[model samples]
Target: EKVQLLIARKIELFWTRNFSEAIPYNNLVIGVPKEVWRNEKRIALTPSIAANLVKKGFRVRIERNAGLNAMFSNEEFEKEGATICNKSECFQSDIILKVRQPLISEVDEFNEEATIISFLYPAQNQQLINKLSV
Candidate 1:
């Protein structure tokens, strides 16, 4: 819990200190996966969050139909200045925020050097740790 809080605080601080530069000036790209697994309906980053990031000058790209199951549409995200992209292009982003770890099938979509962050179910996902080690 302490670690989580500290990480959260660090994220908040990062946004506070660097959001202005990170978004507009640096051409930061963020990727979000379309939910594929069962019972994963929640989107880790919503259009509202995308809007905030854009307001700070960041460019966000999301996988096609990623938010459809969540009742979010491509038009809504586009309205917030986020670009809709194929899974491959989404993985080319500088950073990725995913609700779940990359599945074996989607592993190829990730760029070799991009930073991908996601939640892993350790008990059932030892393979994810190994895959991400790449």
Candidate 2:
């Protein structure tokens, strides 16, 4: 039985390694940031995305208090198997999907190597882009 258990563990590791290799490194960690617009009740990605990410074997981390404005609670996100983290940690994810342009503080909160995905209204807020570029 001990030998069987060892074999099973090896098989699991082998499969996991293969699966991870098949998926691109960029696709591994996904981040979802909440829009900071005043009275903005819309959320870019909902719990549905979290569920989908879980099914795809990807890790999701959302900014704390981000979904509350949209009426989605932290519990809902957790129930969908998404990891709830602070703004700083969430910005460290490989990909960040956002509904609005990132705040200056939020941009500074990002991990230098992380990829940020958002609808940046550069035309409306050129100063923000300039600030971020610096």
Candidate 3:
């Protein structure tokens, strides 16, 4: 029991702790898009994480040039089995991973059931939240 507790605590430390319904990795496609917010130049996923997810049977799609700001090349992601695609294609994935709140136009292009993980500051982004809630 102590060992189990220790391992669980380690997982918790590295986990996002969404505590929501879990989705099978194989059934989901994770996408990493370029941060378009002015002066905010961070990509959501690293090549290592993409490789790990791919190994776990998840499809990872990264937008072309998405990680340029972070110094991650497409070849790196490709080596990890992630598909380099257009921004629109990336946005259509089952899960969109990003660092900034998406613009309204970008949100409109998201897949109907796509799960987006980002820094969504709801209080400051009421309009974005309203649009997303729709």
Candidate 4:
């Protein structure tokens, strides 16, 4: 009976750990900053998408004026459960999503474990790549 109880406990532990890791989503904060590049007017993560993420337990933060170019107002995002914050606040998230590659100077604003998602041309921007690597 002792051996059977030990085996059952071990199986439960194993399944708990494995299944916990298998869950696809978490309550990670996702940040969306405005496009700062000249003539760049694109914005990532529309209000509808942000709302869907919120419904899925993710927190979405958008920088002020982030969606103006895309004709998306801050009120629209707020209505969809997003928080509109300053540029720096947007950088302090678990994930940062931008429409274009961020400037080298902007790389320092990222959180140590933050993941940046954008359209980067590393070949054309070695300096930016090096800054990001640091």
Clashes of each: 3, 0, 0, 0
Candidate achieving higher lDDT, 2 or 3: 3
Give a tens-digit lDDT track for model 3, residues 1-134: 99999999999887965667888889999988889988886888999999999999999999999998889999999999999999899989999999999998899899999999999999999999999999
lDDT of 4: 0.90
12-108 per-residue lDDT for model 2 (tens digits): 9987774434556436888887678788877777998889878878888887778988899988999998888877777888778888878877777
- In candidate 1, stretches whose alpha carbon ends up further than 4 angstroms from where it belongs are 1-25
How many steric overlaps does candidate 1 have?
A: 3
* C-alpha RMSD for every candidate: 9.8, 11.3, 8.5, 5.1
Error of 1 at 20 (Å): 19
lDDT of 4 at 28: 85
Predicted model with the maximum lDDT: 3
Candidates by lDDT, descending order: 3, 4, 1, 2
Report every candidate's CA lDDT: 0.81, 0.80, 0.92, 0.90
Q: Pick by TM-score: which candidate is best?
A: 3
The 10-residue segment of model 2 with minimum total lDDT is 18-27
Residue 124 CA displacement from its true place in model 4, Å: 1.0
- Local accuracy of candidate 4 as per-residue lDDT tens digits, 1-134: 99999999999998777443433446588999999989988898899999999999888999998999999999999999999999998999989999899988889998878889998899998999888888
By TM-score, how accurate is candidate 1?
0.75
Q: 3 or 4: which has the higher TM-score? A: 3
